[model samples]
Target: MSRTQRVDRTAVRTRLDRVTDPELDRSITELEYIDEIEIEGESVAVSFTLPTAWCSPAFAWMMMTDARDAILEIPEITDVAVDLRDHMHAAEINEGVNERLSFDAVFDDADGDIEAVREELDEKARAARQYRAVSALLDGGATPEQIVGLVRKDLTIDSEGRTTVRLDETLSICIESEPIERYLEKATATGVANGTDAGLFVTPEGETISPSEFETVHRRGRLAATNMSGQGHVCANLAEARIGSASASD
Candidate 1:
C-alpha cells in the first residue's frame, strides 16, 4: 500500500469538534458521541455511537457525512472512514456515506431529503444562538432598539476576544466575543445576516424584527434554545447509560 502524509492528531480533533449534531446543534465531541479516533498515516477512521440504537437515520447520516467532510478539510488527510455503531440504520448510513451516495438514494423510504432537514435544523440553531447573543448584549447595557438596529458593519471583533458594538457615531460598547461570534456564524451561514447593510438580527423566519415584536421574537428564541438544550441533556444521560452497559458487557 502507498504511504500517506503525516497528520496532526490534535488538529484532527479540533476539526471534528467543529462538526455538530444537527438536532442538538452542539458539537459531537462535546456530546461524547465520538467513541474512537484511529489514524494510519494520512487516513482516519472515526467510530461513533448515538444515544439510542434507533436514533433517526437521517440525523445519523448527516453526522457521519459531516464528520468525514470535516476531517478531509485538513490538507494532509487523504481519506476518512466514518463508522456509525450500534444503530438500526448503521449499515446503510455507513455504506452510503463511505461511497458518497445521496441520502435519498440509500434510503428510498425517507420522507424528506437531507438538505431540507439540514436547513430546518440550521434555522433552529440560528435562532437559539441569536437568543444567547442578544442576551449578552442586553446585559452589557444595550437596549432593544439599539440591538434591533444593528447591521453587519456595526460589530467588530478584536484579537483580545472582545466584540465592540458601534451604537452610533459617538458611542460604542465592548462585550465578550464568544456569544456574538457564535451567533454571527450561524446567522451568516443561514443568510439571515449576510450583507454589510443587512440587519444583524432577525426572526427565525428571516424577517426583520419590528421593535414592537422584538419581545415575542426573543421569547421564541429562548424557547428554541431551551428545547435544544433539554434534548441534549436527555441524549447525554442516555449515552452515558448506553456506554456503561457496553462496558459492563465487556
Candidate 2:
C-alpha cells in the first residue's frame, strides 16, 4: 500500500472555519468543536462533537452537511466523510448526510424557484417574530390563562409604573412602561435570568428594539441574580468585579 500524498491540513482546517453552528451562532472553529481532521491524498475524514447531545438534530445535520460541502470544495478532495461523535441521533445524521449528497440524483426532475422560495422565507420571518413575542409573554410573569385571553384580539395595558403588555399586528406584544431605556434594562435582565439569548441595545435607526438589546437585558438579569438575590448575591459581587474590569476597557 502507498500513501497518495500529504495535503496541507492547516489550509483545510482554516476553510472549515467558514462552517457555522446555527443555534450557537458561532464558527465551529471558534467553538473548538472539531475533534480531528485526517487528510490522505484525495480523501478527507473529519470528526466533531456538538456542545450538547440534545441539540437540535436538524440543525446539527445541516451544519455537518454544510461543513462537508465546504471541505469538498478544497482542491484535490475527491471524497469526504463527516462523523458526528457524541451527539444524539448520530445514525440519523449520517443518513441525512448521505441523503443530501445524493439529493441531485434522487431529484433529477425537481427544480426550485428562487424567487418563490425567497417570498416564502420572508413570510415565515414575519410569523417567527409574532411567535417570539408570544413565547416571551408566555415565559414571563404572564400566565397561560393570560396568554389565552390575548390570543387574537390586540392586547394593551396601561400600568402606572408597573409593566404593561400591549400587542400590535406589526410588533406583536409591546410592553410599555417608563422610558424605553429603562424598559430595555429590565427586559434584558429578565432574559439573562432565564438563560435566554434575549438582550437589549439601541438600534442604529433610533427606533425598534434590536436583538443586542435582549442580550444585554439577559446579561444584566444574570448579574442582578448574583448580586441582589439572597445567598446568590455574593456571586453578583464577583460579577461586579468582572464587569468593572470589562467596562474599564471602555
Candidate 3:
C-alpha cells in the first residue's frame, strides 16, 4: 500500500467555506450544499448539490472550480476531484472542475511572481484577441443591440460592446454604448415586466452592466427559466428594481 500524508479534515472544511455558491451568494457550507467529503489516501473526493438543477451551468461550474481550488490548498491533498451528482448543471460542473484542476496543477509548482507574471501576460494576450474579435464583429455590421446580446450571452468577448462583469459582490454595466438611455430603458421595461426595481446597474468601471445583473434581466420571465437560473429569484419581482438592489448587497 502506498503511504499517504495525513489530511486535515478541519482545514479542508474551512477552506471549502471560503467558496461561495454563485447563485445563492452564500458559502456552500452555509447553504449545506456540499453533500459529502471522502478522503482516500492522497486523493480527496467532494460531492455537492446546487440549489436547483437548471441554474446557470457556467456559474455552478465556477463554484465547483472554486471549491476544487480551495481543497487543493491543503498540503496533504495531492488529488482533488469534485463530484456534482445532484447538481443542476452536472456536466458543466464536471467539465469545469476538470479544466480548473488541470490549470491548478500547472501553477501548483510555480512561485508567486512567476504565476503573477504569467497571468498578466495571459490576460494581455486574451484582451488583444478579444479586441480583435469585437472589432471584426462590429466591422461585420452587427447592430449595437446584437452586440449587447452577444456580450450578455457570451463571456468570451471583451470590448466596447461587452458591458457587464461580476467580481464578488460588485456588478457593473457599460455606459459608452450610444443611446445609453435607451438600453437602460429597455432594462427598465424588462424589470417592470418582471416586477423588479432597477433591472440594471452600472459597474464600478462605469462601462457595463454586471454579469449577475445581466443574468437577472435574462431570467426575469417564466418559471422554467427562473428555475434554470437557480433559487435566488424564487420570490423575485421583475417589475420593480428590488432585485437589482438586493443583488448588489449580495
Model 1 residue 156 distance off true place after TM-score fit, in angstroms: 0.8
lDDT per residue (tens digit) for residues 135-159 in model 2? 4565555443344334212333345
Over 4 Å off in model 3, which ranges? 1-5, 99-203, 206-250
In model 3, state the lDDT of residue 194. Answer: 23
Determine which window of 10 residues in candidate 2 has minimal summed lDDT.
192-201
Q: Which candidate ranks first by lDDT, i.e. highest? A: 1
The TM-scores, one per candidate, come to 0.95, 0.42, 0.41
lDDT: worst 10-residue window of model 3: 197-206
- Model 1: CA > 4 A from native: 1-5, 247-250
lDDT (C-alpha, whole model) for all candidates? 0.91, 0.52, 0.50
The positional error of residue 89 in candidate 3, measured at the CA in angstroms, is 3.8
Point to the candidate with the largest TM-score. 1
Clash count of each predicted structure: 0, 16, 32
